[model samples]
Target chain A: MSDRLPGFSTLAVHAGAQPDPTTGARATPIYQTTSFVFNDADHAASLFGLQAFGNIYTRIGNPTNAVLEERVAALEGGTAALAVASGHAAQVVVLQQLLQPGDEFIAARKLYGGSINQFTHAFKSFGWNVVWADPDDIASFERAVTPRTKAIFIESIANPAGSITDIEAISSVARKAGVPLIVDNTLASPYLIRPIDHGADIVVHSLTKFLGGHGNSLGGIIVDAGTFDWSTGGKYPMLSEPRPEYHGIRLQETFGNFAFAIACRVLGLRDLGPALSPFNAFMILTGIETLPLRMQKHCDNARAVAEFLAGHPAVASVSYAGLPSDKYNQLARKYAPKGAGAVFTFSLKGGYDAGVNLVSKLQLFSHLANVGDTRSLVIHPASTTHSQLDDAAKVKSGAGPDVVRLSIGIEDKEDLIADLEQALGA
Target chain B: MNHDAYPDNYIRGILNSVKSIAMVGASPVNVRPSYFAFKYLAQRGYDMIPINPGHVGKELLGKPFVASLRDIGRPVDMIDIFRNSSHIMPVVEEALTLDPLPKVIWMQLGARDDAAAEKAEAAGIKVVMNRCPKIEYGRLSSEISWMGVNSRTLSSKRAPAPTQGMRLSLNRMSVGGGDTAASDRAAKNKSEQS
Candidate 1:
């Protein structure tokens, strides 16, 4: 596949996906169905019981989503993929495989606000605990560890505020603990960073953002590095031990290296039922094909926007890892060498009200809670996404009262800057 | 970047697996907040030992009340306080005295005793001030599972089931045999209309 697609441009337009045979359509079709018929009762029984591998239901697997999965896996250099309902779904599914009741995992404190909620409250209800470690302080991670920890997670480039993680160092810690490293590669996209290359055993993405490109669909994906030794630990019963639901078939033993992906599909998706829509999968597949091109342009536009805000009289500070003056710039250069990504935070000199005014005034940029679209987006996170968080959590997530988050898109640089300028002026 | 000295993978596994909880100021009265709070948690399979010398040796909410933390036979994962902040230090002190201390000391809502919190914090316990686990659970997960709504659903009512006979009557309006002003106007309209 790599040989067939020699360049980013070639890969974007033609990788993993082939023309539809039945309709002769070049684009991937949306496979909208609740269930699929097996060849015979024996095949159905085999699929249901894990003796054979095929789509038993739409929630477990789909033909259209499979193309998107394979494409992202190819792009990220992973063995296999799992397409989920949302990025949050991807995280939940991954945890379901790695963690049991009373298990724990460590995550970087600097993550998306929703992730904080999921880890702190939702996962806690199930007895899965998350130990918070500062992404900047790798030692805190080691100090926080107890005997029950199962995995280490971080974002390649964190959301809202684009702070790059030292994946290599974190991966080293995970290796020492005999655990897998999971990286949320949504912000960096595969074009900006390949987490697997930095030693991340699993890569997760909210495809609704960058990979979907347009705000039309919602989806998420998880890619397995096929690197972690699941069988080594007696910890993961769903993967290492025989599953009772599947007639005692051991996923790790049967799938060999890509057992994590197989487990996510056959077990997590089968039971939990957070399956991505085929239309969403198709849209994300289309977006991913042009990821390299859009990502580069998105970076270019974002860098210009960051530079503009850094010097603006009305702006107090800008927080893009791409900015040379940024504290995380050095880390960004090492980890996400392609680009520091499109999302960033900037504070208004006039404070919170003025930030809201600027958002209301901006015409080109949509004021929604979403990021990674081809269209620029702006939001006062304190008033929206982080509103549910208490003051302590809000401050920790960097969504303070005066801070305004922007997700730069692949638009004309001058037009985007001019819009920001007009909005800031108003 | 200064790496966190602690490895992450070894830290997260045991943060929430609280095996035992010492309920400070657990109530004997069924209507009190402490009663329901203790009951919900005790129902969730946590080893809950109630503390309130007033209710000592009494079995309320299905758990026996003890005079102090020392009275409990085993170590606990957390300490859930239903008492006010001012009266917490002595309990926290006793909680700290146990060998292999509790990991979390959660102060119930309206229980903001900073002095006690600091002491617990100093003792390496994660202190969650003024938050209820039951409320957090309801907000975070679907523990209720729509069972309450489904049980009283219209179709399920008036069925030939023994449980529904009382459930249907209790769920409907209870009209007394003697008509008052409110019922007389409603009853007059009912008699004249048909």
Candidate 2:
């Protein structure tokens, strides 16, 4: 199944997912076990001490997950990848590898809720801090940086809110700061945008959503653009300095451009225990085979939905970047020229009651917590997901009580709009 | 007709009670916050029903997941919504039509909708904005245990972990979960038992 001069659909179906050599199975098989056996002792030490790259444990690597990692890296235009348990895990692992406690990182304020919580609350426990910056205003990043800052993060297309980050601007800022710029590409899912092509040093994804396409599996990946110079960074001793963990082997010296992925695998995954299951990896791969197709349809459907919601009598406003009048449309065109990703928010005229009524009434759209699925999802942020925050914090996050978010699926445009119309009682 | 009075005052009381929460966006996916929060809250013994229309009949932690709140049949005290903000109106409407309107409408960390909040508040439902129930449970319950030095109160001179003598695991003492109101309950309950 190796691709040969194939299109995205063809490559997605074939790339890195060739027929199983041992079993000759057409579909990817789940390698559901803990440890892999070594042929010999020297081979074992070579593996344990990073002398060779081979699977030691399911936590570090799995053959099934490897296919997914390789395929996503290939699709995302990166040299290598590390598949982890979830997107948040990829972020935490990347930060842990980059920072040595007391370190800071600049991040776009309009990020996914979990990432916001992780940065503000969880990571603080580890002594890692995040300074907020607007991706639209890249200079905010420079102002936030200090001697201890290790990275800058921005979403390729921020979730639920289609805010396209100017990757080139942020990447330059990261380069100036001597740190890698990590981009969360879950919403864009590689078909619509490739972060590395725009100067990103590393890219992360929550395969649970768009990348997995069908919403059946949950996975996350970290891809190395192979651009960051680990040896010269001086900030990351884990890569530049000798590794006591692996018989004092220098990661940067041993694994040239792909050193970051290796670090993520050998140290982060091994310690964090947030490894992706082989079953989930197989499911994600199956889903990605339809990534481009699904994403295009999703974008179209979302744009249509966003338009209808904006124009509807019961609706107050919409936030899709595809809409010319949208605040983010310009950035979307600049960053996501092909199309803005398929998630957006809108307000209802009746406020909270209308929002709640719409969720129960929508016959077509499913009301769920996640986005980027094949079917549309709706949520009232005020009453549900963001309710724990104070009113001030909620305002800062752009989740006011009256707003509703839609993760437009790859469904028929008319059906999506019709559902909204019916839900809105127009 | 003041919309601000929509939720009966004392939002905390509406949210606090013998509870089971059905998280609509709950996933087994580790990358998603819903998975962690669902599992964490479950570990704390809140009956969590993971309702994803995609996996309607399937189970995450072996609990039957009815697709929508409409499918859940009986009333639950709270429906902790994990969905996006734009889509909340329908869920709120469904809750309002429930046999007994849910006591509270809990939005997850990133979720908010003003119209939906106003509607819910107008219906005498308490609205808590941009917060997670799992986090509140952790902070409010004595379960937050002993957070280290940083776990001290944000403003008050008194430390939450009074003794400073005991050690705290990261999970037992977390920063976001320690709302003062919930902590007070945890303390009162503990002292009464003693």
DockQ of 2: 0.01
Off by over 4 Å in 2: A1-6, B1-194
TM-score of each: 0.67, 0.67
lDDT tens readout by residue for model 2, B1-194: 23211122233243356367868777755435576567666655567778788877678867876888878877787788887666777888888888778777776654567788888888887776445564444333322211100111111111232121121122221122222222223223332333
Kindly list the per-residue Cα lDDT of model 1 for residues A1-426, writing each as its tens digit.
011114445545554454553565667778798787777775565456543334667888886887777667657767578899999999999999999899889999889888988999999999999999988899988877788999998988986688888999988899889888999999998888888877888899999898888878999999878667676649788888877776566676454445688899878887999998988888888888778889899998999999999999999999999999999999988877778999999998999999989999999999999998989999999999888889887878789999999999888999999999999885
Instruction: Specify the CAPRI tier of model 1.
Output: incorrect
Question: TM-score of predicted model 2?
Answer: 0.67
Fnat: each model in turn = 0.00, 0.00
Q: What is the interface RMSD of each candidate, in Å?
A: 30.4, 26.2
- Name the TM-score of candidate 1: 0.67
Error of 1 at A389 (Å): 1.8
